[model samples]
Target: MSKLQNVFFPLLAVVAAFIVGAIVIAAVGDDPLFVYGLFFSSVFGTIDGLSYTLFYATPLIFTGLAVALAFHCGLLNIGAEGQLQVAAFVCAWIGFTFNLPGLLLVPMCMLGAVLAGAIWAGIPGLLKARFGSHEVINTIMMNFIAAGITSYLTQYFYREPGDPILQTKHIYEQAHIARIAKLLSPLGVDLPQRLPLNLSLLIALAAAGGTYFFLWHTRWGYDLRAVGANPAAAQYGGVNVARNIVLAMCISGALAGMVAIGEVQGYRYRYYEGFSAGYGFTGIAVALLGRNHPLGIVLAALLFGALQRAGLFIDIFTDRVSKDLTVILQATIILFVGCEELFRQLKRRWAKPA
Candidate 1:
């Protein structure tokens, strides 16, 4: 395929997915046009809608990058969900417990979250590297451990004092994120009060860029990529595959953890039960759809974010089709993407002279 063809792959996948979605819509007795119309409007109708989509896209960027990082090391990270939750809880605790100046407090809170996330993800990496354990099994089990530990911390250790709610106390005023709504108010846009977009969005973008530079430019990333592509060759080349695996997993976990910290610190300013809402798992799909490229991951996350932001509207406008259809769409996209290499090979064969 030419460069143009390579670039068109995602667009083609989206078109194919939508065609399948139309079939699903027909099967569910709804008008596909109306459903798609609702989707486009919800994502692009107004500045408010676009802001919501961007806000939703923020954490997805983190999780997608996390998964992409792990993929580069030939490791599948399925524990981002738990790592994010734990990091959020830790960041919230720091933000609330301290009263330092914003300059000092912000970095401290962020550092706390990153460290916690890395540690949470690093354990499985260590086990896999040292003991030759399968990362998939170990990471899955570690997710359970993270969940339990976070649940306990939230329930007892970090629960707000004298509050009936099962959530932490609000962070310091200075720690609260500046909302995009505040910025849009000057432009005469009346955004809904429901969704919150914060400064962490900038952080996520920076992380995405950093991920790209690291993967494509740095020597360390080269080593990690070498290991990912061929472990035996990398080992023979003395690249320390074990160390790279653990480090890559830690980086991936840190990104996931940053999602929660960004969300809570910028929006809620508190840790609550069910704060994540399955972002980690969705990130796997996003990474796959993006082909593990930093830019691709960002775009893929934006697509999913738009879909999620518009899902409720789809349900409201077309009651026949359930909101779960968005999930179905995401699952289908990932499944198809998984077979992308096969499709490429087939296309190559088809183009060959008879």
Candidate 2:
């Protein structure tokens, strides 16, 4: 019954969101059915569309897992945005500065990204452990600091000479990850040569599997969840609450940093300023809708990715409806999911003896 509810409620929320979205489309004097048909068909009807959707989903998977891990530790990690940004900068720095072979440079850049993100996130974690300062405030402040610092560093050191763009030099070919199109060529499945889907999708899948294993099948995960559920009880049971807090955030940040592998190594091959179109923030909604499970996160990320792809078609094909309708639908889904606990409480209250 609980498992059924878990699936049913999210499905309910998604359906509600679409219903509301259809109403909005009608208000705009558009044919909601036609618009939605185009939207869905564009995302799933073609191979190129599916590839693009998966490419967009890749980073969301990383960020969503990052948020889910921190939530398991009773922490809200809003700093994933900053963590990803700094990690991308470091990855780009290593990619452009090094001339090593692909085998060596790829892992080297990845390690740099992970370490940079972990360290940046560790500061707030340490503060929360030592001073009892709220991680939320500290993480939010860290985002601003990270943005300013990265911006200054990119302008001062990484930006190409006389180039107005605040971005690093293009990474060498040695650091590039092969695109999905090339990989599938051997199987005779022809994909668009320029599709952005790449090897990082595999990394995202691996991270999800690793996260599931770490949280459910490991002793450390046991300790972490114990601390999250009840810190006093966990401390009485000999779990070091403070240490777990810091450790969880570090792991979360490391996962978030994997976004760099997709953006820098896989697609753009450089650190572009403002490349993140709120993927970190959107990840909160994804995690909530997914109920913090790896399989659910994958499904939720794919939905959002499809919405993103569909929004473009809506703009081009619909006369009255704009892409903002997609934003409204996303917000509605978040709202319904966020209120789920309240609904559960109401149901319980109404069912009580009266």
Candidate 3:
């Protein structure tokens, strides 16, 4: 029943959100069916749309996993945005600074990104474990600090002289990763070279698989879950809560850091200051909508990815509807999902002794 409900309630929330979204579309003097059909058709009907949808989904998967991993340890990691940003810079830093071949340079960038994110996230974890300071507050503050530090570094050291953009020099060609279009073209598969979809999607899927195994099949995962479920009981059972807290945050940060693999090595080839369009923040919604499950996260990311892709068509084709409707729909979905928690709390209260 618990497992069924985990899936059922989320599905219910999505359905409810769409139903409400449909009403709103109609209220705004548009045909809800046309709007819905356009969104679904564009995202699913065309190869280009599908590619872009998956491309957008790639980063969301990384960020979603980051959030989910922390949730397992009873930690809310709202700092994935900052973590990814720092990691992206570090990854690009390695790529541009070192004149190594892809074999060495790629691994170095990945390691650097993972380590940088882990270190940044670990500070909050350390404080939380040592001082009982709230991870939320610490992580939130860390975001601003990360932003300031990264901004300073880019402006002072990384940015090429006379370059107006707040970005680093492009990584050398050796650090480049292959796009799906490039790989498939050799096999007579027709795909546009302009498509940003790349090998990072595979890495993201692997990360999701790795997360599932780590959380379900490993001892460390068990300890993390135990801590989350009942810290006192976990301590009684000889689990080191402090270590798990740090470990979870580090792992979460590592996953978040992987976002750079796609953005820098695979697509942009440099650290763009604003490359992320809230992928980290949107990850919280993905994690929630997915019920914090790895598989669910991927599916939810695809939904969001499709929504993102659909928005362009919505804005260009529709007369009364705007792309912001997607935001409204997402907010609606989140609200409905939140209501599930409310319902559970009410049920618990009602069942308690009067």
Best by lDDT: 3
Candidate 3 segments exceeding 4 Å error = 341-354
Q: What C-alpha lDDT do the candidate models reach, one value each?
A: 0.86, 0.91, 0.92
- Candidate 2 per-residue lDDT, tens place, 1-354, comes to 499888988898899899999999999899989999998799989997898899989889998999999899999999999999999999999999999999999999999999988888888999999999999999899988989999999999888899999998999889998899999999999888899999999999999999999999999998988988899999999999999999999999999899999899999999998999778887887888899998899899999888888989999999998888887888899999988876688678999976
lDDT of 1 by residue, 1-354 (tens): 466765577667777788899899999899999999999998999776788889888989999999999999999999898888889888988898999998888888889899888988998999999999998888788878877887787778778677777787788977766676666678997666556877788889999999999988999999999999999999999899999999999999999989965688788888887888689999998898787888888899999999888888987888699788888888888776777776688779899966
Q: Select the stronger candidate by lDDT from 1 and 3.
A: 3
- What RMSD, rounded to one decimal, does every model reach? 2.5, 1.9, 3.1
lDDT for model 3, please.
0.92
Q: Compared with the true structure, what per-residue lDDT tens digits does model 3 show for residues 203-265? A: 999999999999999999999999998999999999999999999999999999999999999
* TM-score (all chains, Cα) for each model: 0.92, 0.95, 0.93
Residue pairs clashing in model 3 are none
lDDT of 2: 0.91
Q: For model 1, what is the alpha-carbon lDDT of residue 201?
A: 85
